[model samples]
Target: QQPVQSPQAVILREGEDAVINCSSSKALYSVHWYRQKHGEAPVFLMILLKGGEQKGHEKISASFNEKKQQSSLYLTASQLSYSGTYFCGTEMAGSARQLTFGSGTQLTVLP
Candidate 1:
C-alpha cells in the first residue's frame, strides 16, 4: 500500500522549514520522493533503499526508516521556488520497480 503523508497543506514563509512524512503498513523495497509544481509532472528528488542509503538533490534531503517502512522529506530554508506538491512513492517488496504513490501533500510558500 502507498504511504500516507501528513499535513495535507502547509503554509510557510520564506526561510521557514517543514517536514513531510510518508508511512506504509507493508514492507517496502524502496522509497522515492518527488516534487511537482502545479500543472506539471513530478520531479524526482531522491531514493532510499533498504541498505541505509540516502540521496538528495539541491537542498532537499530524505531518509528511509527501514524498520518502520517509512520515509521523510526535509525542506530547509524555504524558498519561493519550493512552492509545490510533494509525493512519496513506495516500491513493494517482491514487486515491480514501479511505485504505488501516496496522495500528495500540497505545500505553499508565502512571501
Candidate 2:
C-alpha cells in the first residue's frame, strides 16, 4: 500500500522548522525521501532502514520507526531553496527496487 503523508501543504518562513510525517499500513523495509522542484525531477534526500535509523542531509533529517511503520522528515532552518514537493517512498520487506510513494507534502519556504 502507498504510504500516507500528513499536511498536504505547508508554508514556512526562512530559518523556520517544519516536520512532515509519513505512515504506512504494511511493514516496511526502508523509506526514502525526495524533493522535487517545479519542472524538475525528484532529487534523492536520504534513506532510513527498518532498524529505526535516522538520516540527515544538510539541514534536513529524517527518522524511520519500523515498529510503528511510520517516518518523519525534519527540516531545520528552512531555506527558500527548500521549497518543493517532498515525497516519501517506501519499500516492503523482501521487495527490491519496487518503491511505493506517498501522496506528497508541498512545502513553501517564504522570506
Candidate 3:
C-alpha cells in the first residue's frame, strides 16, 4: 500500500517555495513524513491524523483529506535544510504504525 507523492523532483531557488502532495487510497490512520539526505537514513519530520490531529516536527505542516484519502505537505520559504528526498508513509488496515513509502521526491534548493 504505497502512497503517491507528486513532482518527483522540485527545483527551487533559495528563498522560494514549493508544495509536495501525498495521497493514499487505503484507510489511513496516520501519515508520516521523513527527509533523507544523500547516503543517509531518513529523518522523521511529522505526522497527521484521521482525527485532525497534527504532531511532530517544526516549520512543516500537512493536512489529511478524509474525503479524498489524500494529504498535502507544505514547505514554506525553501531553505537548504529542506534540500533532500521527501517521502510520505501511510498505515494500512490492521497495520500498527507501519509505513508504506512512495518512490521519493528529490528537492533541491539553489542559491
Candidate 4:
C-alpha cells in the first residue's frame, strides 16, 4: 500500500526547521526519500532500513521506526534551495527494488 504523508504543504523561512512524516499501514522493509524540483526528475535523498537507523546528510536527516512502520524527514536550518516536493517511497518485505511512493509533500523555503 502507498504510504501516507502528513502536512501536505509547508512554508518555512530561511534558518527554520520542518518535519515531513510518512506512515504505512502494512509492514515495510525500507523507506526512501526523494526531492523533485520543477521541470526536474526526482533526486534520491536517503534511505532508512527496517533496523530503524537514522541517516542524515548536511542539514537534512531522516529516521525510520520499524515498530510503527513510519518515517520522518527533518530539514534543519532550512535554506531557499530546499524548496521542492518531497516524496517518500516504501518497499515491502519480499519486494525487491519495487517501491510505492506517497503523494508528496510540498516544501517552500522563503528568504
- Give the Cα lDDT of each candidate: 0.87, 0.95, 0.82, 0.96
How many clashes in candidate 3? 0
Count of clashing residue pairs in every prediction: 0, 0, 0, 0
Put the candidates in TM-score order, highest first.
4, 2, 1, 3
User: Which 10-residue span in candidate 4 carries the lowest summed lDDT?
Assistant: 90-99
Stretches of candidate 1 off by over 4 Å are none
Query: TM-score for model 1?
Result: 0.93
Put down candidate 2 lDDT per residue, 1-103, tens digits, no spaces: 8899988999999999999999999989999999999999999999999998998888999999998999999999999999999999999988876999999
Q: Give residue 111's error in model 4 in angstroms.
A: 0.3
Kindly give the stretch of ten consecutive residues in candidate 3 with the minimal lDDT sum. 51-60
TM-score of each: 0.93, 0.97, 0.90, 0.98
List the RMSD of every prediction in angstroms: 1.1, 0.7, 1.6, 0.6
Find the candidate with the highest lDDT and give its number.
4
- Pitting candidate 3 against candidate 4, the one with the higher TM-score is 4
Measured by TM-score, the strongest candidate is 4
- lDDT for position 39 in model 4: 94
lDDT of 1: 0.87
Global Cα lDDT for candidate 4:
0.96
Clashing pairs in 3: none
lDDT of 3 by residue, 10-37 (tens): 9999888778888888888787888999
